[model samples]
Target: MKLDFTLKRFPINGRLKEQSGLPFSCVLQPYHRLPEKETSAGDASGTRSNSIARCAQCYSYINCYCVFDTAGWVCSLCNRHNALKPQQQKRYRLDPTVLQELPEVRSEVFETLAEDPIPVPMPALEGSPAAQQDPGYVSGPAPVVVALVDTAAGEEFLELVRSSLEAALEALPPVTRFALITMSNRLGLHDVRASEPSVRYVSLLEPQLRPGASAAAAAASSPAVACPLSDVMPLSSLLAPVGSFKGAITRALEENMVPEQGFGETSDAEASGSGAAVGPSGAPGQEAAMSRNSGGDAAPGGGVGARSGRSGGGHLPAARGLGPALVAVLDYLKVLQSPAFASVKTPDSEGGLSGHGSGASAAAVVGADHLSQNPSPVKLLLFLAGVPDFGVGRLV
Candidate 1:
């Protein structure tokens, strides 16, 4: 035969959803080991260009935002944990080194809340039962699962979440167990309740491994009765019905717990634009500062370690009745909206959520009345940190 040319065409789904935008994990695959001579040439630069290519700054799972060459993805919890910087590191002075040295801590619930939280208790809903004695409908409490999404880049993102969680827990009654879920694409659920006190090991729940899990569970985790904190998990999708979730969450609080008077409006100096107003310095259980600051890149490590490696953090607890909690977190992102509104930004607009038929106009459906119905009050607390700069206090 003179010549043979065969072309295999890759299939294109041809389904056009949304138009252009700016953007954009590999774990394992079969590969032939290169000879020592080839490896030596690759290592000659001494830039650690050989081992494995990873970001200098790594998260707990696969990196969602890989802009920083120094950044790598770990798990969502670790992503939030790693979002903290050196200056902000003081807030969580738990001594990770010491924690790492401790033996595994079993299912002991530790209340991180302050002895007395800021006392602005909202009026409780009238007539709601303290405990539901009903059958199938009431399954103890919805499992608690919290998912911390990245509002912006920087270590502060993680610190903000940690501070918020500590403050929230301090406000709640003591619990026996908890779990933590952080997600971008890949979901990681670390069972904090399962760990033996002193030892640090996360029981990872990977989505790929278990495809049957609900988006909420995959995004967050099951809200078992024991771990109340697990209620905060990733939402079904950014565009799902956040208000419905909020309503359910609010009902849960009114029935089972009391709303704490935690944070208040910020004064001009303190309210200089960041989400939360800057509270007094050294206020126990309070985040020292709030700013729109970004994070810096960690120094690079040899190839893959920096790019793909786990970030460290303990497991979080699961909470009872978390469906609404998941909804509240989803709503905070300002992505979900009713179908009635038209598009706000252009189809190709990069500012807000895309992929939906409507663009910026999509946000119009997220009205205050909708948020008022939110079942979970805790989500509102979380949304306070992520909402855009506006009169948020008035809106709440």
Candidate 2:
């Protein structure tokens, strides 16, 4: 691939300081295949082998950029010389025409396989239970999908999400693992794999607050608590096998109705007017409306808008807690995509129950290895119905 840079001379120094007028960024999608190479695997010259020419210092694969001579090859990345093995030397002595036919020597991008005389058995490390339970480990990484829905949105928005998720389920391969999360004033984790699937609540504000103290006191005493997504649920439980839990997932989506108050108050004129009249604390009329909306039965004291009286705890009148929610989910996605973090074994009990112990970790390692060797491919699909009005990047 050709690289175009704004600077006249390449910045050889490792430090990448911000330059006033220089556009120093480029986005390339390597995985996107050309029309001709879409169906085919390009050249067939590259094969898997135990040994291959690579950079001694940087470990970069031997490619068209490398300089080859009688003694050794010079790595283009680090400019280090790597001596050729006996077999490599013999291959180098072949006819010029035969050497040209080799994909690694000619093509910019080529495939390779590890040389394996006998398949090495996977080791069952004692500390990592995730690697011990599942024996039917696959060779490649299965795709993963995480859905973050804004429960503060309107009925129309929720309906659209339902339809979109249904379509997504149909389009995704059966092997794909999926997880669902919802956010309003707080975050909700839907455990679809449970015997009786239900939405587990995670209080975004309370967790950050001091026990028996007000929300204001918490904010005053300490910075907002950063809750890791993994802490919300075990990694094994959070992601469910889509094939088996499709129905449960659909039900979770269907049941995600807007809360009576909080951010959802804007959905109804009466609630909004009442909210306005009562200011940020939430009005009696709004509470009554919320109660009536729930089949004329009063919502429990700890229901939505209960903490509106607390400082910084009022119902979000305009844009809800979209910013923090998105950040949390995005952080979780980053963890999922990271090889080192994703491959870490879960507890033995957790792995045993999920039946994905060593198998899952192995898949993660393989996926990570593929990503490290090749350009990592990722895509983020965000579904939003309103503006982000909480924490950083708030528009309203």
Candidate 3:
């Protein structure tokens, strides 16, 4: 099979381009025939391995482009040197078959990994959005859809977003839960279960933020957002059930969300020929692309669930307080609790987002490994109609 692209680059000004724009989906046909020399498994079907080598930093699968050495291999994509396990090192020295059998090393295009995510019993109130649950009994991991709306994106552009989100709402699985956040110099968290369209505004600005750094870093560096995300809205309310609360979500998008004047060029700028380069990358908006972080293992579950996707939070000029908000969200999910994210204190029984946050550093630069690594994947869709001209990561 042949492949093509829709965009050119992935990141824009230290921000994740997955939230940039366009569709970059890959349809994996497991039953398709493989090229003659491509299959190391000696069949038309590709290699089936229980384990695939992955970069500890970026969580990307190791591919043919990696440079292998005596100690370990350097990730071709992130250029981070990942040490091989002792057993893996021994296997590399003793048995040449290990390298020969790795699908990532053998095929440059594709490979099938047979990962068996433990199947959980469907929750009793599955798809019943209005259903309440035992506060203590957390269900399995459910796919989280956080739509970060740029409130400054005028009515016309927002209308397009409204329709698109509505269409996406129809396609979502019954168990999926979604969170809505509106940004334009400040942050607003929406509770889908509220009687009316309820959005609590949050100021996430820190006294000082180093330029060209991610929001994740600022949260790690200084005092976090004015309040925790749950403080703005509880996790239970944040992740509203798509099945029952579909109408509520649509209403929240419409009712009182008026566009705020921003510092960037108008929507007409793109049509009039603005040459800011954007690329087609498999990002959180696309479920499949979002799952790439966890070896594509987490089947979009919730509570007691762990998955990883694109990490680090980008702060737009129009979206200022976004960093602390995301850190709060990740804290709610316990993303940092995973060893992959950081080496934190042993979490006690009490569960809540508190001090010593996990995500990025106190530095101006956001490292690739200092991001969403494993076991907690949150799909964040940043809806922007124009380049941000206000805060950090501004196009200007």
Candidate 4:
């Protein structure tokens, strides 16, 4: 329960400089109290109170570090005096019986109300469909999982993904939301919320090219044309409710696995046989034909073949377009977590500790970047088949 700082001199500006070029950091693990058992009468009044006392100036929670007095308590962090209410003063009285009974005042950690100190009301919808419904219908943010599958991924990898997703269905909470996207020469956005889930395609090949450009130009230009995944479909549609569309999503994964293509007619056959189905829009046998037509001549659909390099000599190319797909998903989530979109008021927002309390400090230290300032929670899960081959971090 004791934290020892190895640094003799603390950084006043919160920046540590070293000549070794490596950042100085320290790991801190806070103390946690065990849960108490219930009583026979089910009246847990003897246990710690639901409400927590906090400093008025810094809003820091009352912990063992705080110095308690008959009139008020002194905050350790900000060194500010906080006057205690009549009830708090009585609870922390000097009597031996009260001191023995109320251990929460002396404990480093204890249970309290799970609610936000300051609550923000959601903006009212004027003309939307939901506006006519119950005025009190409040929609909290749902957990989101986005799976980015590589088209260049082999049949084995795709099969593994399918199995993992199936397992995830049983493990993930019913209220969780899931989205599936595929990357290769192009990006495929699967709208699983629809009655029949289908992938909408977006070409990664750049549009601008000279009259007599070579096949290499196609590969070089594709990164420029790659658009955000959110543009293909709204986030609401892409992130389908797992509880309602688990079956539909499972079927989409089974039917829409795209394989490495544009190698040649022979390799295309092998890819199809290995369970790599053509995109949702294309027919079963059309992928091979398109690959053959696009491979020989750069004039017709050369962009496809060029963007997706040939798997010549029976060697499959590394996955392509993963970087763009990831970027798109990240951008979408960032916007979702922004203050503009997270307008809904949840129970946690109305009942928890203030933003400056120990709760906020813990969250800020744990995952400051991932956790949004807004009360709504956002989660992202990425599944990669292999290294990306076509973007800033491409291996080649």
**In order, what is each prediction's RMSD in angstroms?**
29.5, 11.6, 16.8, 14.4
**Tens digit per residue, CA lDDT, model 4, 331-369:** 766655664343233345336433111121111111212
TM-score of every prediction relative to native:
0.20, 0.51, 0.49, 0.52
Per-candidate Cα lDDT values, in order, are 0.25, 0.51, 0.51, 0.51
lDDT of 1 by residue, 168-218 (tens): 554543220122333221122221211010101112222222477655454
Error of 2 at 280 (Å): 30
Q: Candidate 2 at residue 221, lDDT?
A: 52
- TM-score of model 1 relative to the true fold? 0.20
- What C-alpha lDDT, on a 0 to 100 scale, does residue 216 get in candidate 2? 54
Quick one: how many clashes does candidate 1 have? 83
For model 3, how does the per-residue alpha-carbon lDDT over 18-94 read when each residue is reduced to its tens digit? 56655644465556766767555433144344445678999887766677876788886677989887645654442
C-alpha RMSD (angstroms) for model 3: 16.8
What local lDDT score does residue 172 receive in model 2, on the 0 to 100 scale?
A: 73
Give the C-alpha miss distance for residue 160 in model 2, angstroms. Answer: 2.6
